[model samples]
Target: MARFAISDLHGCRQTFLAALDTIGLNKDDELFLLGDYIDRGPDSKGVIDTIWELERDGYRVQCLKGNHEQMCLDGTKDPNWLPIWLKNGGRETMGSFGDHMPDEQHLQWMEALPHYLETPGYILTHAGLNFRRANPMEDQDAMLWIRRWSQEVDRDWLNGRIIVHGHTPRTLSEIKENLAYLNHLPVMNIDAGCCYDLPGRGNLCVFHLDDQRVTFMPNRDR
Candidate 1:
């Protein structure tokens, strides 16, 4: 059994699935999804549906909450957040559903998702932690929304475990460069911007946790 992680689906269902196939995931292998399953590209509802399907099929798929997921949940609860969510590509998400809204099951699933996860060798969160905080792990909001705080990572707090996250989209080259310097910088961003179709973007990334392998699947949801 192996462990794999992918992040920032951003509604690119085909690319997400293709990445999974590229990884050759199996039931015994654990799949950690670093969230942003909705918004931006296309088929947000379908992406969530595929996650549920994988769980039902006995795949060990664990999903963390992303900023987009938080925005989606807040948008449903408050009117003010609705426009912000839509402006940030939530409109595309709504269009993915025939009814232009998420169903109860999907909403509840998103609502119940944990913001962060910790294991022996890795700290998994949608976004990086706020190292300035005394206990970065305790800052749930930072886990969902913080950006550009990687430089502040509290190395002593992390000891030797690497931090794996996806929120701030970076080019494929930048993502690979990060892995090369993993010995010095313990944080890695695997988001290749599945929602972005621009240069150096649009590839969905799969990070093999056990052996530290990276696979890039080109965006196909265009």
Candidate 2:
């Protein structure tokens, strides 16, 4: 059995499907989805529905919560978050829902999603932790929305576990260039801006853990 992870799917259902097809996901293989499943792209509902179908078919899929999802939850609680969410592509997500409204079951699932997941070799999260904090894991806000990190962060902050995260859009070249010795720890960012229609972006990426192989599916729009 193989293990794989993908991030920043947004709502590009076709691109996501193509990535799955490229990866040849089977019952034996496990898939970790690192959130942003909705927003910024077309067919947010389709993305959620496909995930539910995959689970129904007995695929081992682990879904994580993303900042966009946090925004979604916040929008439900406070009227103030709606405008911010809408400006940041929440309108596309709502449009995908059409007249049915956001699914309650999905929202509940999103609410229960863990902020981070630990594995033998890596720490998985929607966004990277605040290395500057004494206990980075305790800073919930940084785990969901942090875009930049300092070079002076504690190198041993994670005790040797590399952080694998999304939420920031960086091309493969950019990721490689930026993987410098940051406080002696390394971070791997896999969000290739799958929802974007611009150059140097808009590719769904999947990383095969055991083999350390990366596969990509170009966005349907491109």
TM-score of each: 0.98, 0.91
User: What is the Å distance of residue 30 in model 1 from its true position?
Assistant: 0.5
Total clashing residue pairs per candidate?
Answer: 0, 1
Q: Model 1 compared with the native: what TM-score? A: 0.98
The C-alpha stretches of model 1 lying farther than 4 A from their native spots are: none
The residue-by-residue lDDT of candidate 1 on 1-222, one tens digit each, is 998889999999999888888788899999899889999988999999999999999999999999998999999999999999999989999998874778788899999999988866999999889988888888999999899998888888888999999999999899999999998899999998878878999898899898897999999899
The candidate that wins on TM-score is 1
* Model 2: per-residue Cα lDDT at residue 222: 35
lDDT of 2 by residue, 39-70 (tens): 88988888988998999999998888899999
Candidate models: Cα lDDT each: 0.91, 0.81
Cα-based lDDT at residue 217, candidate 2: 79
